[model samples]
Target: MSVDTATKPHDRLAEALAEDMGRVNTMIRERMASEHAPRIPEVTAHLVEAGGKRLRPMLTLGAARMCGYDGPYHVHLAATVEFIHTATLLHDDVVDESQQRRERPTANLLWDNTSSVLVGDYLFARSFQLMTETGSIRVLRILSNAAATIAEGEVLQLTAARDLATTEETYLKIVRGKTAALFSAAMEVGGVIAGQDDARVQAMFDYGDALGIAFQMVDDILDYAGSDATGKNIGDDFRERKLTLPVIKAVAKADAEERAFWQRTIEKGKQDDGDLGTALALLDKHAAIDATRAEAVAWADRAKAALAGLPDHPIRGMLIDLADYVVARLR
Candidate 1:
């Protein structure tokens, strides 16, 4: 279907994302409803029914369509991406002890953690099965590598938390592994499955990587700046003592007194009533938030540029807009 990019006050990019999101939604529902274990259906359904923007799967679909893929396997690949994403969310909520996602109770909150964890595994296995059905070993390798990178990233982030010595290079590695790996693999597989040339496939991979980095950077920024209404709590990362880009930058720029405060709160996990405001002020004093936003915009620009060599189409325009949308929240 052709995307209409000129219909609203918002950028046409958002509209295009919405259109691709609809197709991804259908694929997620149908695939998640498999007649496997009865309990599997119920548990998996709970998380799948929880609304998400379906951005990852849409990236897969958009990349495929933009590269002139006319086959139906794109649907299966999109579903595979969503399942992987959902599984990760289930595991993440359990690990983070988070209560809310997308303004709804997390899977671990609604069901027991055991159920959430096991169902997450089931979904991962299902994702593999779906991809294998496509019979593309290259696709399988791409996704499997992504899964490994995601796990490594999560572990890296876990290790970095509360460690004052964590470097910016380590921080970027964690984000790339945790956030951008799947995105890169998803878009790369799309072009690969479509039999696109190596350069085009690599371009899609680069685009996804940059876009994912930008997306995650914005997410980290929003944990400090966004409202609870956006489903992100202020100082959420701070409360967890997780060192994100802004926090790391602020720590580097902090004076002795500010450094002591970070040691007390982040290292000791003992936050005062005014800690959130102090953290925000420190980040502001260092211009960390602005710096982080600039980094996000740079990655997003790279994502847009990666698409320059691909063939022109409405979907290509949509992909460009989608990259823009990833960092638009910061604006």
Candidate 2:
């Protein structure tokens, strides 16, 4: 099912979020339109034009507004968050050799790998520049730490690929590093810049962390269950030999023949025409999908619970709804 952008859930909260994000979008467009290096604007615009949910930057803006921040610096911070996220996507496409994102050709697919990488670096540098303008050492520290964690997470996933011995703890670490770190940092910076109390800041961080985990879990589930029309290709991760949650659980519960199947397909990356069917069967037989869904729900619940101590406001309610929406597509 498609999400309705015009009439999103939690109307008032979404409106507030949209107003905050509008300033962010304007800033991103203006910053990215620099003429110093014409290629910078051209190449960066390719990825920027590729539509995404803009969830990370939205989280940053939302957290700031919810904490009573009226300053204009939130716009710069939101744009910084988006630039960082976009830069990561460019690098990720190069690493994964992915052709499609958001139902369009990835930057790496449209341009050469060198262009993707260098432009991605430029965006990173620009993001850092924007963050420095905030003059908040704590915000800088949070984002810098997140960038490091994201790198570590990517490397960990690289090592874990096709490795049948990866444990649940290692998997959690990978998810937290690769996905949740930025989410947490985005919210943390929002709180920091807003001058929120320590407890509230921590709570927002926790909320973003849980929401990100749940969001990624649903993405994993979608890879197996969502329709191709939704832009999710089934078995793509399986074909890539990436052992996500469903595959991890399925591997653990595999019987002798099932074990051999996983060994050949996941470890060796060999598969026939019916391999996806067989994998799905194994997932069903072992109830792996159900388990993964349960984990996603648990994380979503934790995200909602994290907002309990925050002051009652429409934005807080929208954040709760956004957390639910992340996992709602799974159903």
Candidate 3:
């Protein structure tokens, strides 16, 4: 047997659980099918087949297996996690009015907002159905709360994303809502299903929370300094007027002229040529990217530290490496 050096740590993790992942993928395809509407599969298949890392579901599987679960329910739980994540992406694209995702046209653009939103809703409903199959009220409660938290986070961002006065504290709250909630739920459910003790479950939640914050902060920095490898457009956050951590830090330290520049370009939406370049220069002037990267690394450290109490399985090492990998793009 041979391994591809190009295979990422997450990829290796997936390979380690190929049988479970295959079941998860199969379950997802089966569950996503709509009885009356062929369009549902078409729209979903576009994004589902877009080659996301499937990291969330893998986390669920890894957490469960690391705790010594051999039951059939982990597969259902993993599928539910993936479905929830996909539904969120569909809704996020529509909400952002985004045109591209994973380098392909977003479902909202290829179809319409109505389809995307409805499909997302359908998946959300389907996710609930899958979770119920496990008969774990604890898992249901956790995932449902995460779903609500994700929505709440998005709404918070609606008010806060464009406002220049958005503080880092507020920004972190938004991140916890839209992004970290699911990650936390994804990992926590694993421990719950594996019948782990409360302490271990809390550890799982802690790991996911820190890892997710690091993941999102890395994404914020990548928006300024990404290559094609990231599959995201550089400066997308700047162009979208979303006040990520880098911009938040820079705004917190801006002089009068720089404040005015941000106001005109972001608040007023009166962007001009070289505005992105000017934004980059301001970020450099303040070393906002470096500071933001440092924060992400700190979160990564927190995530790894949370794993110390977990079982000393190979999956634990992979999960820790995953924390490192999430922030590695900054380097």
Best by TM-score, which number? Answer: 3
Task: After superposing candidate 2 on the true structure, give the runs of residues whose Cα lies further than 4 Å from its correct spot.
Answer: 1-7, 10-14, 98-111
TM-score of 3: 0.94
lDDT of 1: 0.84
Candidate 3: residue pairs that collide: none
lDDT of 1 by residue, 1-331 (tens): 1335364213443465465566667767676665756777787776777766566777787788778888878878888998998899889977876522433565446566777798899889989999998999999999999999999999899988999889889988998999999899889988998899999999999999999999899999999988443677688888888999999999999899999999999998878899999999999999999999999999999999999877788878777877777787665
Ranking by lDDT: 3, 2, 1
Count of backbone collisions within predicted model 1: 0
Q: Which stretches of candidate 3 lie over 4 Å from their true place?
A: 1-7, 98-111
Q: Model 2 residue 47 lDDT?
A: 79
Candidate 1 displacement at residue 230 in angstroms = 2.4
TM-score of each: 0.89, 0.93, 0.94
Worst 10 residues of 2 by lDDT: 99-108
Best by lDDT: 3
Candidate 2 per-residue C-alpha lDDT over 1-331 given as tens digits, one digit per residue, 9 for 90 to 100: 3656655543445477787778788888887866666787787787787767677888898899899999988888889989999889889977876523423555446566777798889888889999999999889899999999998999999999999888888888999999999999999899999999899999989998998899888888888887554687788888788889998999988888999999999888778999999999989988999999999999999999999888898788889887787777776
List model 3 lDDT by residue over 24-142, tens digit each: 99998898898899999998997887778898999999999888989999999999988989999888878777523434554346567788899999999999999889999999999
What RMSD does model 1 have?
4.3
Model 3 worst lDDT window (10 residues) = 99-108
